[model samples]
Target chain A: MRYLLTIVADGMPEPEKLAVLQRECPRWVHEMDGRGVRLLGRELDPPEATTTVRVRHGETLVTDGPFAETKEFMAGLDIIECANLDDAIEVAASHPVSWYTAIEVRPFAGDLHLGEAAAAFARGDACGEPFLLVTWMGGTPATPVHDQAVADEGDGWRRDLDRRGLHVLGDALGRPDTATTVRVRDGSTLLADGPFVQGEDFIASIDVVRCQDRQEAVELAASHPVARHHAIEVRPFCNE
Target chain B: MTVKPDVRQAVDAAFRNEWGRVVATLIHRTGDWDLAEECAQEAFAEALRRWPSDGVPHRPGAWLTTVARNRAIDRLRRSERGLQLHEQIGREAMLDDITGGSTPVARAREIEDDRLRLLFTCCHPALSLECRVALTLRSVAGLSTAEIARAFLVPEATMAKRLTRSKAKITAAGIPFRVPPAHVLPERIDGVLAVLYLTFNEGYSATSGAELIRTRLCDEAIRLARALHELMADEPEVTGALALMLLHHSRRHARVGPDGELVTLEEQDRDRWDCAEIEEGQGLVEEALHESRVGPYQLQAAIAACHAGAAAIHDTDWAEIAGLYALLEDQCPSPVVRLNRAVAVAMGGDIDAGLAMVEALTSDPRLERYYLLEATRADLLRRSGALGRAQAAYARAIPLAPTDVERRFLERRLAEVRATGADESGPRPS
Candidate 1:
């Protein structure tokens, strides 16, 4: 359920290595944490400062260097608790070093005794709120349906949700170009921009609701008017 | 040095994801499934050594397969048995008869032929209908046995055995991986079209996924259908399958909400529908209908065309759809088809007739546990003012519904009936 992703950034010596870890790793870690995956990351001292000793025939053989003689050394590690290996792998694979240095993913071997810290990391438990995010292109409202038309046509949906004691959150009318664009340049600082790369249209709004998982959230969102025209992106919120 | 963990993970993901496509291309080029798979594996192994340092190539599959093929050739030169086969193949290569290219499109075409070959081989007359479907889904559609089992609501182990037996039959009967002769093309093409249609349907309305629609799967199925259409332009069913896929896909944008929730057809915004795809699909339907010889696919396409042509839910020609469903039943009489036909009949104002048809289908063993069937019957009953029966039907349907969304929807229907306190509904649920 939990994996420690150890990214070994070997060859690149000096401040460049530390800079990459400092700037890139935190952003990636924050994104994962935002998605409800508990993350704890730290940078380790260089391998040269580390010591490894082997005992054979009651004799100790001490080595001044690291265990593996690879260009990249174990620079840092991020501990992530996920629902399953697949989920963990998705997170690990998205790390900055996934495309460059070697990332070692090892499952947590045993249960942890975190004491009071565990409660602080527990995810939120809000669920069963029905909401529809209707996205409109060019900042336009959905087709003018008389209150009667919606009450008539969407009666089935309303009746269904009402029986379940679920109430739809009020709709958001998004700006013409509401998306915030971020670009990772030269594997460093992210460049922020306005409105997703100009296309035929832009994402108008996002419907947010409290649900159990992606599947439930998606199904509930599908009934919204905006989904009929624009793309829908689903992301679960961290309970905390 | 031990392989870097990140490199290992990337290689593994790439292997799992790209292995099939690479093997498919190699199998077509080499004309040997086992050898192509081996070559593809070898190529990936080489990538593990080089990619971390040099960075991944722009076209990884092409690079991997080329390296593997060259490695295979070098190995062949070193072996006595391989040398003889290599010489024969070399002669064919010298003759300039074999197609050679490294582009993805060219490789895809080769793989497409292999797909056609696999389709025919899987649907060989010796195989049972279930076996054919399982084999086609596994080999051609690239679905795992577990995925196929989930689709058919069967145990994974049983499905795996079924796949094994189907493969064994192919081997024993010497079913060559090639298209059947022209004389038998019509019937064989039907099997191929059915398999493709099923694949597309599964993708368009995934039985279980966080997303309502799996666009990748839909795209893949459409691409396959298009290839079949191109190969057999004279075949009416091929045209029909392509038309149906286009028409259905044209509604994909309107099928989900901005928050990724499911959307029922009646609530969909008509202006959002892709008009270009609709136009293209309409053209194909017209051509297919002109053939005079009606098939199940063409009939289904006709039905979809009716829905697509409508300006709004009220404007839908329910009578025409009901008529098309009647033809479809005559061509392929299944409980599911009849159930859908009942809805059309109800929409056409023949509520009594629709209710009767639905009631008849409830007794069908094939539909006893089918949630949609119960839901359909409940809708009819509720419309006819039979609240007690409708409530019971909805309750029965709740347990059978697979997804939370469907269950929630059904529960809502049940509540409405209860709230009305046995009053007959004004209009039937669509």
Candidate 2:
């Protein structure tokens, strides 16, 4: 089991103690690495460098501070793979920071990477290769005929990109009203007749584009006729 | 056929010992939790029905596993999901050997690993603490959701929903069902031990436990701990946990009065403590300490051993216990540990110092609502001949007690303090 060990400081350490911990931190990492428990680790910038973002009322809201209201803030983090929960706890307990700060050992939620989704759709083992999931966020609600014409044009463009190994998959979702949302709460499953989140604008379509970098993805995405008028978003597809 | 008494006994024992193994191995083959559980349940039912006539199998665990696997395969063969048929038939080739009634050596070794996988996955930190406890009992300990709900004091429906939601998360999120690779085993030990300890605590402290099922949780936890010990004997913390539980469990009979009220340790009957359990716990703790493995549980077991080894309250080695608690306080740093260390320090002949420590701990908001803090302070005060302050502190503590037994314990102390201070009828105006 892979656990993310988050090291948070209750308050600043004494300068002398900080100096010792700074020296000891590398030795801790090195020992863990030798034991094959520590996979990766990084020291985070202080909370002053934090930027929090949220999308409320269809507008992106950005703030310049940590997201949570706690005096204990994340100081650093290490990804350590333990055999089980007890091993994770022991690792956190032995950490040098544990003497002065708290190490919150949390296991990552099970691997839900895009590879599984690709397998579900029988995406022809294309998951191992790099691909970006580009989607249409929201724009003017076009009639079915107009959408069909655009989709047909997109098919031709997709086939052209496929010849160059840049296109992997593409699809248009049904109208937002056709979406159903499910939530289990209070020992009952509640079914609501709409998308999980209601909005005047909704995701209308998505496509997988193979690319090496975001710059190339953006350049490739900009070539589609839909990007000229409608809002198109390009995101990095998770790679195995 | 009705099950004969002896046959029923054997079946029950098999169910307790082999349910986790059967379900774990079946789930490994089937990749379906509900199917594995259902088939395991059916396999037990089959044992109850057939064992009396069939004279019980030579190896009931292997027989049950073979039965459960066959049932799972039958269900899959009947299903229309062809995509998984090739993958889910992992045990189809081994069933013939298992059915022949002679266990293969390689397959026998896999049983322990399979159970550890199930336990680790159930107690995964990604789940909420309550979810982890609930899942561990249901999946690894083989408790029914209804039984678990009643033990946890929640409605059966709520418990069912919790189990369903957790299982769905496990399936949807692709939580792998395998033991973590060997090197980080030390790192993962505490979480597994914590769930077992919490399970034991839930049963141990239920003073007015109104249900037989609720009180059985202590036995269930110890059984699981014993099972864990058999699997991970090398882990000191695991051994420490088992030792600590046994030491505390050895004193259960002496912990309550005849009227079912809580009895202070000093007032308890030492002769009533089980000697065999004490010996076992002491042996385990000694072995762990000899190995130089001093985790929190081991430290606690060592302290418990001190109390168990004392023939009388006065004979208890208070200084040694105080030292152990100090080390625990430094290592695991909790207000409860500090409170315990204060009591130990006072018992070790420093009443004033203990009182000062308890008094300073009062400003800590965490201890404000804790009744033991005031109780300990009052006890120290009473011993120091400060009757008025002792009486006042006892009165302050009585209402803060969580259970009726503790409340009455405090009230008795208050009355005793009042009897000593005849000059003042009330609390001496705080």
Candidate 3:
């Protein structure tokens, strides 16, 4: 199992404290990596530099800050490959940041990037490699005839993916009527009731697919049933 | 109420103590708050049906936990949406066993930490204050929405709505179920203390009831506070809040007389105070004060310590109490703090000065219907030889008193003033 450790802190620590933490963190990171536990780690920019974008209904909601209102922001993150939760906790607890800030440990669903999907997915393994986000966009609303075709098509695609042992995640989003848009400007949150951009077709579904390379990602995206009526955008994530 | 069997009683007790932990553990496992609560409730309901026949499990918490987790598994396997939740739990189970090699004992400890995480999440500062209080009482103290509504004197529907909104917000906003980091912990700690203190105060001084105290709520509040203190012992405010609660609770026995009349602190028998509680509270106060952060809770605890340290009313260090209240006012100034300070000043020595202070607050709208303002004014006026005005003030305050005990106490003062014919004397005799 791989675990993601989110290091949350209020603003940033003072220069001296940050310096001390920075000095100590690398040593522990090296220790974990040397022991074959650490997979990846990165320090995030300050919250002020963050831009949050949400698409609901049809409007694109963008904010200058993180989605959650909190004094403590995600200062950094680390992904560690461990045996289990107990192993994950042990690895997490050893982080020097845990002393000053909270270390949130959450297990990775699967090793999407490792391209071990065929074997692991057959075993129902949740932990794997890297994840590529496959978004199905701009599909026509289903009518009586279209509904059966869509369902039949979707089932066939699902079975094919399952047969190939491809573990994908995500659910289809509801129509624009059920959507809501939230945007923040100049520290004031402006909420528009209806879709800001109106169209018959919109983002219908999203899935995190395990793929080792661009070719594999594109192949998986092309295999989706929705690709016949909609565009599938395959974006590879830089980190877990 | 019919008498319950021993096994049933034990199950009931276990439910109160273990409900939060069970739910927290399930939430930690599945990351689904609604499902966790639902499964935990189902487990408790199952316990009720089976415990009578099974004669109660040796470890009721463990039994309920196992049953709850299994129930969650069954539900997830059967439901479409729960597929993801089920998968997460399955992965976690595998991880737990394969990685660090968790034993039963280690798992139990993890569950304990889950409760703390749940509490911190429930009391997160991001939630509204009312939402925080309702969530804390429901999630941490394991009180029903209706029960919390009754305790807080709100309608069941309002409380239910408040609780639902808060929970939805928590889920939608992705508030992690964990304690906040050090820098942010102080603000979050304050939010938690506020909820605990509100719980304690509701019990210490019932806002509206025939009785002045509700020991059950008080006990629950103290228990929750102690648990928080144990989990975060280094947090000075947690220690300070616990100390403050203990010092006030030590006087619980003497707070009311045999006739169920409110007993003024000065008139209550000092010997009746719980010495053990006072000693422990004083120790905590010293410990917290030494740390030098000096939060509002620590200041209030110091004032309580002043009263607890005194052997008698005269022995009480009114000046020190007044000084502490002043510092408290500086930190969080309010009409209530000034009112308390005035009383302490009057009890310390200068009745005339206290009366002037009380008079100054006459036009403050917030204190207009505040019974303490009227009661304090009446007391100070009676002591300063203004019987007519004192009797009128007492008359004005009696109707405002929330509890019958306070009303009776005020009526007695009115009778005392009428009988004495306006004598310039000290506080009315009990």
lDDT of 1 by residue, B1-430 (tens): 5777877887766665456555555444545444554566678889899988877777665566567667555544564554467564773352222236356576566655655676676665445567777776665555667777776668899998888766544432234567776755776787677667776776777535623225545765687678678767888889999999999999988977665555777779989899999998999999999988788888888888888999999999999999999999998899999999999999899999998999988789998799999998898888887888889999999999877767877887899999895453455566
Off by over 4 Å in 2: A1-240, B81-83, B88-103, B423-430
Each prediction's TM-score versus the true structure: 0.51, 0.69, 0.61
- Backbone clash total, candidate 3: 17
Give per-residue CA lDDT, model 2, range A17-64, as digits (tens): 799887988788889989988865556556654444333334444445
The CAPRI category of model 2 is incorrect
Order of the predicted models by lDDT, top scorer first: 2, 3, 1
How many residue pairs clash (N, CA or C atoms closer than 3 angstroms) in each of the candidate models, in the order given? 16, 12, 17
The better-scoring model by TM-score among 1 and 2 is 2
Alpha-carbon lDDT, every model = 0.62, 0.72, 0.70
Model 3 Cα shift for residue B222 (angstroms): 0.9
lDDT of 2 by residue, B95-186 (tens): 43444544577678778888988987777654556877888888877899989998988999999988876676565434568766677466
All candidates: TM-score of chain A: 0.42, 0.48, 0.49
Instruction: List where candidate 1 sits over 4 angstroms from the true fold.
Output: A1-240, B1-31, B40-72, B75-115, B122-173, B210-214, B256-262, B422-430
- Docking tier of model 1: it is incorrect
lDDT of 3 by residue, A1-240 (tens): 554555657766788878978798989988997997876555655655443343334333444544345565556656666654334545655676665655655443234233444334323454544343323344342221253365356556655765665655433433333222333244332322222234554444434556566556556656666554444554433342
lDDT score of model 2? Answer: 0.72
Among all candidates shown, the one with the greatest DockQ: 2
